[model samples]
Target: MRVAIVGAGLMGAQIGCEYALGGHEVRLHARDLRRAQQRVDEGFALVDRHALFTADEVRAAAARVSTAADPGDAASGADLLVESLPEDLELKTAVLRAALAEAPEAHVATNTSSLSIAAIGEAIGSPERTVGTHYLNPPLLMPPVEVIGGERTAPETVELARKTLIALGKLPVVVRRDVPGFVWNRLQFALVRECAWLVEHGVASAEDVDVVMREGLARRWRRVGPLRAVALGGIDTWNRSGRGIVPDLSNARELPDLATVAITEGNVSDDAGARDAALARELREERALGAAR
Candidate 1:
């Protein structure tokens, strides 16, 4: 397969590397030459640093990956064109239009975290080709690559995406509807909002809350998952619990933009980074334990 990635950012480069390693030819293309090369360099550095793949494996994958100067150069002969530009709607719509235009026959997917896939399709004038492929951060280690199709997207497009992801050694969960936040973020933010509200109300210290997730919820969810865990006790009890717990969850209608606030308030970004890394590591460890069991 010939894969053309329409950005040279961390996400695009990581995805390109993974596809290349899966035995596909990949092109990391960007408008600016220097930025493209920088991402290429950082991607290679990651391959060298990672403990997962052996030296020769990395060498072979790196050999298959190349760089392109522009979207046209990348998309001309690509079988799969992926838009991994910034999350801004205008930027993504413009890039998707250009890249998909270059290769009308190629399958198109975007890595937008929040934008509407249908709106993007309308902008691109290729509603059937465009799909949402919300790959998790650190795509190599993180699992569950989301495959969501727009309203006008062809069924074949979804199937091809699923086949491609499975071939590349990924778990692709198809989101049947075109909803905002999709599935992953909805579930994630649902929990996060409650946690934030709890912290605000002095219900638990931040450290203590982490323990409940790490030592309590994480253990149970790893074994049976939330739905199955609930089902273990039958639907009647699960319904009773939901009736009690759902109303008590967070009901905040608006979210404060904490990017600048967190920076000004303290080094909350650094703390968040460390905490997230710990959580990701724990998740991987628990997944391994589940597999062993």
Candidate 2:
């Protein structure tokens, strides 16, 4: 398959490398061609470090990716067009419009984390081909891609998105509705909100919250979902125990002060980034082994 990725930022570069590694030809488009190409090279290096493919295979995959001068150039003769611009509706729609004009028949997908796919479709005026393929962060490593269909998105387009993601060896969950944030972000933010509130209210420090997730919930939730885990623990028990906690859970409409402070501080831990990448690689290897079995 020929893929046209309209953005060569971090996500776009990783996504293009992902498609290339999946044995598809990828064309990347961005205003800053040099920076985009450099990022793509870095993406390829990251892929190599992850050990997703052999050295020879990595070289072959790298060869399959090329940078285009513009959206039209990238989209020319493409089978799929992926827009990974920032979360600006106007910017995305404009690029999509330009790219779609070049490849009118190609399937349209947006890597929007929170934006409404239907609104984007409306803006592009091609709802039939427009769908959301919300990939998780570190796109190349993350397996789950939320496939969302807008109001006017054709059923076939949704199916195409599913099939394409599956072809890339990624898990695709088809969202029935085009709700904002879809499924993943909705669940994610709920936990984040509660975490923020906990930290802000002196219930637990931020590091303690991380420890709870890393040591407790994540260990169990990794294999079993919350619902299933509850079922396993006896639904009646959960209903009796969790019912009281529901009312106390954070429901604040505004962002918590702690969260705001953290954002303002921008105190990112470089070690956490390194650890996350290492863990992602480890999980990918495990998944590959499981698939082989």
For residues 54-169, write the lDDT of model 2, one tens digit per residue.
Answer: 89988999999999878999999999999999999999989989998999888889999999999998898888889999999878777899999999999999999999889888
lDDT of each: 0.80, 0.88
| Residue pairs with clashing backbones, model 2 | none
Let me know the TM-score candidate 2 reaches against the reference structure. Answer: 0.94
Compose the digit string of candidate 1's lDDT tens values, residues 228-285: 8776888899898889988888799865453412224458778755755664575567
- TM for every model, in the order presented, reads 0.86, 0.94
TM-score of 1: 0.86
Off by over 4 Å in 1: 257-293
Cα deviation of 224 in candidate 1 (Å)? 2.0
